[model samples]
Target: MTTQFSALFPGLDNPLILKRYPDSSDANLQAWDAADEHLLKHLDESGMLPRRWLVINDSFGALTCALRARHGDTPIDFAADGRTAHLGALENLQSNSLCQQEIHFHDCSQLQSLGNDAAILMKLPKNLNFFADTLSQLSQTLRAGQQVLIGAKAKHINQSLLTLIGKNLGEANASLAWKKTRVIVVTADGKPRPLSKPNRWPVPELGLILENHSNVFAANKLDIGARLMLDNLPVGDFSQVIDLGCGNGVLGLQTARLYPNANVHFVDESAMAVASAMANWALNKLNPDLGKFHWDDCLSHLDAGISADLVLCNPPFHQGEAITDHIAWQMFNDAKRSLKPGGLLHIVGNRHLGYHVKLKRLFGNCKTIASNGKFVILQSVA
Candidate 1:
C-alpha cells in the first residue's frame, strides 16, 4: 500500500499528501471524502475569520491540515471520538511536514472550553445522536451568533437533519450542493441543551448492566452475536483473556464474572467504546485489578510481551460507510498474534461472513463450537 496520497484544495501552497491514520494496506480508500473538500472550500470562500475555530469529526487530518497550511500557525481545536481518527490526524500532520503544535486535539468525551467567540467547522457524522450530543455540548461553549458550518452528502442534508441541528444548537440552513455535497450553516443561540446520556440496559440472565455512549454499537441492548458468544464462552482455565473489539465491555465483564482469576483485557478502536467498557466494568463491580481497557485500532498497540490464553470477538464487518471484512480480518489476525501458543481464539460472527475460513487459514485449524440460523461461533488454537 502507498504510504502517501494527495488531496488538492484551491489556493493552497501544496497538495496535502496524507495517509489513513493507523496505516492500513487498503490503498483504494482515502482518508477524506468530497464533503471534507466542500467544507474547506466554503470556509475559504467565505473569508470569515473568528477569534477561535474548532474542527470536529475530520476523518483524518484533511480539514485541520489544510487549514494549518493556508493559515499558518493559527491555533485550531480538533475533536474526535475515535482513537484511530485522532491518531490518523497526528500522522497526517507529520506526513505533510506541518507543525503539530498548531492544533489542539480533544477527546470528544472531554471537550475543553471553546469560549463564546468560537466558530465550528464540522463534517456531519453518520450517527445523528452523536451529532446531537456534540451540538448540545457546543451550545454551551459558543455564543448566540457563533456559526457552525457543517459539511455533508447532499442526500443526507434534509429538513429533518436541519431541524435536529436547529433543536440542538440554533437556527440552521444549508448551502446549494457542491461536489454532490452541501454545507449546513448553524447559528448558535447560546441556548445550551442537555447532553444526551448514555443508554443503560440490564441483562437479567447474565446479571450484567450495560451502559453505552451514543456512538457505541448495540447501544440499546445486547447484540445477538454477543448474546450467543456470552452463552457459549470457551471452556478454559485461561489466565489472560482479551475481548477484541469489545463494544461496551460486556464480554470482558462477563469473562471477569465467570473466571474470577483471569485478567480480562478490553480493546476497541472507538474512544467512546473504550470509555464505556471501562465504565461498565466498574459499574458491574468486577475485579478492578483484573480489568484492562485499551483505546486502540486492534491488538497492534496492546502491551508488549502480553499473551492471552483466550480472545473473544464479535467482529464488525463495517467501518464507517464501507461494508468490508478488512476489520474482521484484522481482528482475527491480531488475535492470533496476541494469543499464546496453544491459546484459543473464540469468536461469534454472522454465518454469512464465513469467518471459519479465515480462522482456519490463520490457525491451520478451526472448529465451530456453536451456531444458530444467523450466527456461528468458531474457535481456533494459536
Candidate 2:
C-alpha cells in the first residue's frame, strides 16, 4: 500500500521518487498533479539562472523536490503552511538520496523580511485569502522586475483571480494551457501591500475567543460539525486527551478547560493551525502544562508512550484540493491505535460521510452520542 512514484521534470538529472504526505494506497491520486508539471515545464523553458528560490504552497514537495533536483546546492527557501507537505518534502529528499541540507524551511509567519533578490515559485493555494496574504508579503520582499511563478488548474485562473493577483502583487498573466493547467506569471512592482490579519471571534457560549489563520478551517466562526461535537463531548474521567486534526485547537481548548487535570494534545497538519491553537490556548489562560501543540500528519509523529484516554476528531474530508475521505479514514485508524484500553474516540462528522461504518470496522463498535440535521457525533471504545 506504499504509494510512491517517480517525478520526471524536463531538466532534472534523474526522476525523483515522490509520495503524498499521510500516504494513501490509491495510485490514481498522485502526490503531484498536472499543474505542478505545467509549472516545472515553464521554468525549464525559461532557462532562469540559479538564484535563491522561494517555494510556497507545494502540496507534497513535488515543486520543491523537482527544483532541488534541477538546481543542486542552490539556496531554496521552502515555505508551506502544512506540516505534512514540509515533512513529505524532507522524506522525499531522503528517499531520493538528495542532499537534505539544500532546502531551508519556514512557517508562514517567518516569510516576511526574507530580503530581496530571490526567485519565487508558488502553487496557488485553495484558500484565496491566504494566497493574497502571501502575495502581499512577497510584495515587501520582491522588487520591480522580479517575478513570482504560480501553478494552478487552468479553470481556476480567471479574470478575478488575475485581478486579485494584480491588486496584491503586480502585473499577472496566465500562460497558454498545458495539460489543462497554467502557470501564472506575476511581477512585483516594488510597492508594498498590507497583509491581512487572522480572523478572530468570541464563542461566548464556550467563554472562549478563537482566532483562525487564513488556511485554517472554519475561519471567522465555529464550524457546524465542531459545534455539534462541542455540545456532545464525552463524559469521562480521562487524563490524557488528544484533539486529532485540531484546527485552531477549539476542541482541545475546550477539553483543557473541562478537564483541568488532564493533559490535552492539539495536533494538526497545518503549521498555521498549530500556531493559532497555541496562541488561543495561551490567550484563554489555560494551564500551560495541560496543553501540547503539534504540527503533524495525524498522530504519526506523536511522542512515544502518549496513549490517550480520549481522542476527539472532526476529521478533514479533503487534502488540499482533492475532496476525499482518505484523511478521515487515517484519523479514525490513528485514533484507535492511539487510544488506551477502554478509552474512547469521539468524533463529529457530516451524516453523509458514514463515519460510523469506518469506526465500527476499526474498533468493532460505534455508538451515536448525538445527532443533528447535518452533523452526527459518534463514539467508539477501544
Q: By lDDT, who's the top model here?
A: 2
The lowest-lDDT stretch of 10 consecutive residues in candidate 1 is 110-119
Model 2: residues with Cα > 4 Å off, grouped in runs: none
What residue pairs are clashing in model 2?
Answer: none
Cα lDDT tens digits, model 2, 1-382, are: 9988887877886787899877888877788999888888887899996568888888788888887778887888889888888888888878887786758898777666763767788888888988888888888778888888999999999999999999998999899999999999998898989887888899999999999888888888899999888888888898999999998999999988889999999999888899889989988999988889888889988887999999999998888877889999988888888999999999998999999998998999999999988989999999
Error of 2 at 304 (Å): 1.7
Model 1 spans with C-alpha error above 4 angstroms? none
Q: What range of 10 consecutive residues in model 2 has the weakest lDDT sum? A: 108-117
Instruction: List TM-score per model, in order.
Output: 0.96, 0.96
Score candidate 1 by lDDT. Answer: 0.86
